[model samples]
Target: MKLNISDRKKKVINRMYKITLVIIGMVIVLFNDTFGRLEGFVEFLALYFILILITVAYWIFKQIKSIIQLKNEKEKTELLHLKSQVNPHFFFNTLNNLYGLMEKDSKAREMVLKLSDMMRYSIYEGDKEWVTIKEEVDYLKNYIELQDLRYHKKSDIQFSVQVVNFEVKVMPLLFIILVENAFKHGLENLEKNAYIHMNLSESNNTVNFEIENNFEIRHNSDHQGIGLKNLKRRLALVYPKKHTLTIDEANNKYKVALTIKIK
Candidate 1:
């Protein structure tokens, strides 16, 4: 469940206020002169039990609220670190592509413009909690075009995106990590018949993205690279139970499918 930090804090404060009222009621019962007699003492005993129950319940609630807030903070911190990691890794790859374009004396001007668009999007839109589906798709297109410039005729790649609702929002750059992984692990080293197929479709306020790529497996390479691991962490932090991620590997093909329920 996505929780608002302010709303959670307000609940904690309200519970604490209820606890204070319970304490005040207990003090009033102990000090009132009308409660000195036996009947009054009996009333005090019953009231004490009720007050104790309220206090215990409030205390438990406060503790649970504190724990949840702490967990959210930790997740946000980890996600921020992961976001920082993405920029450098992305720039590193793109810069290498730019260098290759320069070396080949290819369309450096067009590639630079595409790179600039990606950089502007990452700097401006990527930092936000959510971005429109159209913006993200444009960014992905730029990234793919840049990748295409870097490796021409060496790999077969198909990308298709269909959006039923253009206003749909999602966490920015979440799917790019998967695309980067496909290129890094699958397309870079394959000598022939390398293929990457990606399809994205959105319906009923849910987005589904799937990527499949064929690659030569390396025994020494880690399957869960930093980008994939960070992507999983970000998904857990942002979507919680509202997302599904699946990975399958067989016949030298790696397939990943992610479904996200969006607001």
Candidate 2:
């Protein structure tokens, strides 16, 4: 019966039952003189007992339904976690085979390894609330190296890091969007003398990242992209008042700076 009834239908039926019982009780109480006083009292007691039984039954049903729902959710979560594990293993195996086929000293082989490392980090560490700064820096370097391989033009790109403690942990993938945007909106549109400069530094529990790139003025647009919007939202959620993000665009150049205070 429970399986056949929808939640909405069950709720409606429950409400109707309550209303009917209430109306019946009111009618019985109002017509007490028509029946003997003792008989009226007996009827009232029976009705009250029935109402108590119904209430207890409903409470028991709700507890059982809650337990079943929780069990189903747990099973679904476990299945998804297993699938996630399988996918990364499959991906890495394929990459390994491809890597073996390439020449030892080939740029393609190097790119494949870098790509594999990036994929591994993204799959395993990207979702983590915090990761060592060193790991994030390595991921960024691999990403930059891959980008460098794809471009035919020799755009000047530089990344510098100054950190007192490499093991200091911060939110993962915090700076990749800015770096990606630098290439997407800045370096890609420029024809000559294109440059991207990035710097990351940490001091007094504060982490700062800055990136600047030159772009063609004709290719500039006034609208903010979704990536930046999402990044801003994430910053507001994760750091609240402890983070600052600033963007400056002028003279055919785009610059972004992000500062985060972490424990």
Candidate 3:
């Protein structure tokens, strides 16, 4: 892709600024000792050398800092791009479910309403880094309701939430991927005794989320895609040391537990 003109200019300007600092340091170090009398030259040389060392070190330090900052910004941008990519798959599945519902169910209208609320949230709020826990919890409920409509009450899915504070903010769509994964891989294939259980609870500024479901053994290529990886990457980007995600499977049942400390 072609770089934007403004971005190209900004890059050029940043390079020039760094180069200018380096050149200024070089000039100060090389020329300061040349313009002093011999008697004072030794003292001048000592002070000048110290000043030059400090100047060069400061410039190098700034250069290293700038490089790290740029690298982090680039990684953050790429992570956001990956997060954006996960949405299309979700939209595709939801629309397919809605299409199936429209053919026979009058409740499709209600489903559409719920889906529209989710669509609005995705379109407007998805781009944001953080949203209130209340907003995210509501989004999760709407999503579960939509999935319930699709499943036609065949699956035993339950979601419960206890919030100590609604004002806490968290990264948008952080937990939905696990819920979607549960539906897509675990509950969708089971013909009997299908179940999904989810809980979200907050205490002491930390949010705990858990989802578990059972599935029949089956091989599907699409199940191993980048959704979970993207979710992990987003968690790393947003929460870093303050988050933990664990997944366990046994007896044809899978569970995912995620904990995040709100900032």
Candidate 4:
């Protein structure tokens, strides 16, 4: 029976019950001769009116609070939508201009195109609840290619994907943070023998990603930044107990392994 009543309904019922009790008590006081005289009775009536006014004021306050909360929610949603539209369109236009200025078949033109595709995916698909594994893999590849173009150092970066089903849906942009951190803290800091290895595989209704990179020990201070923190928070909210993230840092190496149960 309790389960049948929604929380809002239960709250309404409780408020009604409380108001009914208050009214009944007030009526009894008004009818009884406990006050002993007309003036006393009049004073009791005044007190009763005050209680009624307080009850009405409380109800009004609750209504106002609810309206404020609803307005805030609507404003937040609109702001997010506006950001999604503005940021993506701005980047798209800028990238298109850059692409046009570059000579045809040039390496810079290729990089700009790759960047445009990546930005498109990130701005449009990243906001979605989920995306196909193929889409995510393509985005990561584009990101890696763009990064590769920026650095002259010959870092041995490798990414391997073995997905049983490309159509399998997963949280968008889940692996990009780890890859970015690897490049930022690992390859960029190391002068020689820098290497990053990454693998993504899906099997038996589970998806797994692993990344290992070698970095200089002196640049380890900012390795654990807001990116990893946000990733952990998101994993906790989205996957809860269904996902596992393991981190290992030793011998001038950093490795992260993530496993998610798709089912």
Candidate 5:
């Protein structure tokens, strides 16, 4: 489902070539024939039928191929935009954390290396579409670990991860946004209980994701911020109507559940 730019271009070119071939062959059969016409209208009708069939076949193929290309281009464009937004937000958040750490702790320097690795994946790696679920899960774990370190004192954050299939691929940063959202409003103002629970399961060519966290009613003013709003956009663009997304906010608990079909 994730085709690179070059691959998409190649597919378009190949389809064009096939259309060209069909057209040339049709032209040859229609005009460059050796048969002399001493026949009735039925014979002419038969010839036209064959010609129309060939052209119609090619035309249908052309249309289908064009639709696929257009869809891919649209998806690619949207994903790149998501990556742009996500990379900056991620950098800003991480740098803010790092800045706070640098002000009082010397070990912040060591954590910078890990941050660099994360940045490498976000900024330089192949993030145009789906990445191996394993890679994304690992990235999520690293983020949670870093957040734990940042909130070492007076932070009661509980995080969990479950990866059922390493081979399955998912849209990049699909699950992490929920984690970030949970931390932003969940951990930032921890008065009673601050906890984040995440679970991922893959079966029947589907990915099940759930993230639940305690929500402080006070900080939930900006409920539809850039992150969650953009996340919904990304989900619509990537999964269309194939995936199911649910948000449950009740009893001071915020929960997000989405199931994506990988197949």
Candidate 6:
């Protein structure tokens, strides 16, 4: 049987009511006849009342815990749903750009075709909660290469992943999303000598990621785009209060740093 939360709560509530009524009856019966006559019975009833109170309190605590768990699960579901959209949106846009590249540059077309593997992973494996750091790093490399082919401008764009080891696992597409965002919003048609740098490191159970990009900073801006907003939302859902994230933008330079611990 599928037991809804309300049903289980009502059942607990009814049990509590029955216990309360029984205790009231016991108190009435104890006071009426056994007031000064019975010595031990009154003490026993008092102890029983204390036990009943304790049991009710325990049940209430458990109910509160269950409610908290439900809320967390709901938030996780929503975060995953949001994450699911990012890859396809990125793919369609990149593929359209790739189509334009195909018209004249056969080499660019061939390079863009390699993106299909990343697209496959984004569509299939990216759905999972976490993926190996090696996979994520490889994907980031391909993404950077794609941008390199598209940019047509050189010497300004520098990107690399600095890490000690590549065996650990992390939330898939987490760092990659930020890299994509840097290229999307920061790189402009007017700007020359734009630059982006990224580093990743892991020790024990903590993973650190830092990225900085030099862009044409527009005046009076709240933030960059939905991608960065989505990145923050994902971090919140996956890490909650356990992780640390910071972003700094000053004098036309943007930097983001994130530290996540796997427990």
Error of 1 at 114 (Å): 1.3
- The true-versus-predicted C-alpha distance at residue 199 of model 5, in Å, is 1.2
The number of clashing residue pairs in model 6 is 0
Which of 1 and 2 is ahead in TM-score? 1
Clash tally for model 3 = 0
Task: Please write out the lDDT profile of model 6 over residues 1-263, one tens digit for every residue.
Answer: 98899999999999999999999877777676756645566677779899999999999999999999989877875665456344565566667777677777777656766687787767776878778888887787778777777667763566555566677778778787677767766664335777778887787888888888776656325345666677777777778886888988888788999899877
Instruction: Estimate every model's Cα lDDT from 0 to 1.
Output: 0.81, 0.78, 0.80, 0.81, 0.75, 0.74
What stretches of model 4 exceed 4 Å from their correct place? 1-105
**Ten-residue region with minimum lDDT total, candidate 3:** 78-87
Per-prediction TM-score: 0.71, 0.61, 0.71, 0.64, 0.64, 0.70
Candidate scoring better on lDDT of 1 and 3: 1
TM-score for predicted model 2 compared with the true structure = 0.61
For candidate 3, list the clashing residue pairs, or say none: none
Which residue pairs does candidate 4 place in steric collision?
A: none
Instruction: Give one clash count per candidate, in the order shown.
Output: 0, 0, 0, 0, 0, 0
* Residue 112 shift from truth in candidate 1, angstroms: 1.1
Query: Local error of candidate 6 at 179, Å?
Result: 1.1
Reference-based lDDT, residue 194, model 2: 84
